[model samples]
Target: MSAAETAAETAAETATRRTPGLVPVGETLRSAERGPRQPAADPGTPPARMPWSFWRLLGSELGLTFRRPRNLLMLAALGVVPIVIGVALRVVAAEDGMGGIIEDVAGNSLMLTFVSFSFLVLLFMPVVVSVVAGDSIAGEAGAGTLRYLLAAPSGRTRLLAVKYVNAVVFAYAVTAAVALPALATGLVLFPAGDVTLLSGTTISMGDGLLRIVIAVGYVGAGMAALAAVALAMSTFTEVSIGAIAATIVLIIVCQVLRAIPELGSITPYLLPTRFTNFDAVLRSPIDTAAMGEGLLAFGAYILLFGSIAWARFSGKDITS
Candidate 1:
């Protein structure tokens, strides 16, 4: 062939190699059409972090817990019992002169609040706390929503923490449910004046109110510790009622042991024993040593049960 014809053939081959959709002599048509592929990500690169906030998850949990009709009814019951107690005491004072503890409550609204706390903290408040805390995990698992919650960006550890915190919030709500209504009823039905301590030392009304606040906080801490126990039990079963019942049964057994004079050695260690330690707040100088011991026991129970909950929840397979 002539030199110009040879050159023209070479130019045509080069154009074919560079053209889109046309495979080169050694390459596949798919490779030519697709072009160069993207490089794989580095093995050391961290994952794209989730933007979901912890507070939002906590808020959602709190809303669900408090909005349930059953929980609301429990709160209503807690609020009403104090009113009933106040009214009953008033009636008894009118019919037959109340003496001793009854007379104190009948005369002083603050005493009525203390008496209500004494009655409710043992069984009623624990029942409410157990109901809320026990249902935190088991209810979600039973409903088959727990898997979806875990599938979200929220980690198991964070979710467990949020559940416990939600329970603690409900525990405080329980305290207020008993406290506020009792205070209102006491003020309405009974006279407000200086509080006579169990030690018979009279403190000003302002001091009495402060002691009530302290009592509320102390009782709340005790309930929160119980909540940790219920939450741990919740992780072990998908049946919420089982967990709640078990917690209440445990409380009853402890109380029974506390009632036995022969079991005095173990009574101080029981959770129920600490529940009424709020009486320490009713003393003249305030029994800080006794209250401190009670608070310490509350903290120890929380740590022990909270660890159990974390261990069980973090490793468990989410079938539900």
Candidate 2:
């Protein structure tokens, strides 16, 4: 062959070698036509972090909780108790038939408020809290929303904390719902003045109002412990009703055990044991010792169940 022909053949061979052998040039062009493909995500790689806003979660939860018809009805029902009690006392004072029930509604309306609070804290507060805290987790799971929520960038622990905090806030809100109405009704229907203490001493009206505020706060704190436990129960089940029922049942069991004379030794440790210790605030000199113990117990329970909720939620399988 001539030198020019040899060089031309060598150039053709090099060009052929440079091009793909199996895939045609047309196929390569088509692949290029398709834009760059993303690499598959590494299974072991952590997801991109999302900025979690505590206030946003809290606002959303609170908005959802209060907007529900049933929850609204429950809160309204709580507000009604004081109205009924106040009205009943107003009538009873005129008749003078019920002596043991309320000694002096006509003289000191503050007593009526205290009585209403006592009745509220016993059952109403717990029931109200159960509705919120009990449904916090189980409702999400049962509604098939928990999986999506967990899939969000927010960590499970942070989500649980938000739920727990929202439940506690609801507890306080419900307590205030009861107290404010009672105060308003008492001031309107009955006369408000100095309050007579159970210890046979009297406190000025301003001092009395302060004590009432403290009492309401104490009641809210006591219910917060129940709310925490209810949240833990919520984590264990997907049925909101089941969690609520279980929490109420637990309250009943504790109350029954507390009332049993035989179990007096252990009853002191029960949840409902010092629930009424808020009354100690009404004493001429406040009974901080009793209130302190009650608050401490509530704090301890909050820590115990809150930890359980975090552990369960963090490791939970998102099947739903």
Candidate 3:
């Protein structure tokens, strides 16, 4: 073969050798234009889902609620009140020699706990619970963080659920803040022994503590119901204070109505009226029927208010 022909043949051979590994310029341009290739999904595989961690969101919410200075201060005030009540009773008993219900409470630590609950649950507990629940959504909205929260993977319904659950948990915590301190203060200040029920029957100290536990649980349920009302109010406004004030006003109005003889028929349905049903636990046999009625009322309030809150919040325009 000629030299030129041999050179041409060698070049051809080299080009042929490289062709398998080399992409055509047109194919390269097209591939570049097409961008990255995604792997084909298998028919059996589930579709990709947004990562939503409900528990984590709840935990974070609880942490924020508990850590707030205002909330902590309120809890401190609740814890302190029981101590003040026990001390005041002890002082009164020492000076004036007490009478009637005061005499009973002065002589017994268990009775003192019940008395403290009686005084606090009427106003203090509902106030604190109202503040927390009323602030849940409205506070977020007022601060402009609510829209950002909604922007995340957390759905509105899930967010609302978390807010309500957090409020309920805080309600229980508020109840404990009262009961535990009252019990501790009572044990420190008064005599601990058998407890005399309102029915004139006596129970062991252990049984008395159990009764106190039941009372605390019942009171906590009542507070949770109140929280639901406050949460519903929260959904209607961006101002947290407005919601809080509205709930407190509603509570006061209900209490005023309950005091009127003319409203006797409606008193049975009032939420504040149910707050005192923990007294049923003071009876020897334990007034389960009355307590059951109170619990049913609480459940009804929770359901009604919860639905209202959900309805309002789901459609609320988050401009903040």
TM-score of 2: 0.82
Total clashes for model 1:
0
Q: Itemize residue pairs with steric clashes in candidate 3.
A: none
C-alpha RMSD values across all candidates: 13.8, 13.1, 14.5
Q: Residue 175 of candidate 3: its Cα lDDT?
A: 95
What 10-residue stretch in candidate 3 is worst by lDDT? 20-29
lDDT of each: 0.88, 0.81, 0.88
By TM-score, the better pick of 1 and 2 is 1
After TM-score superposition, the amount by which residue 122's alpha carbon in candidate 3 deviates from its true location, in angstroms, is 1.3
- Candidate 1, which ten residues in sequence have the lowest lDDT sum? 21-30
Tens-digit lDDT track for model 2 on 1-320?
99999999999988778432233323333342442466778999875443446678778988998788988898889899999999988877787466654665566767767788788887778988998899999999889887666545455666788898889888988888888898888888877778778787888889988998998899889889999989999998989999999999999998888878998999868888878899898786899999999999999989998888877766565545
Residue-by-residue lDDT tens digits, candidate 1, 1-320: 99999999999998667553322223322332333465777999874444356788888988988889999999999999999999998888886755987889876789888999999999999999999999999998888887666655466777889999999999999999999999999999999998889999999999999999999999999999999999999999988999999999999999899889999999998998999999998998999999999999999999999999998887676666
* lDDT score, candidate 3, position 152: 59
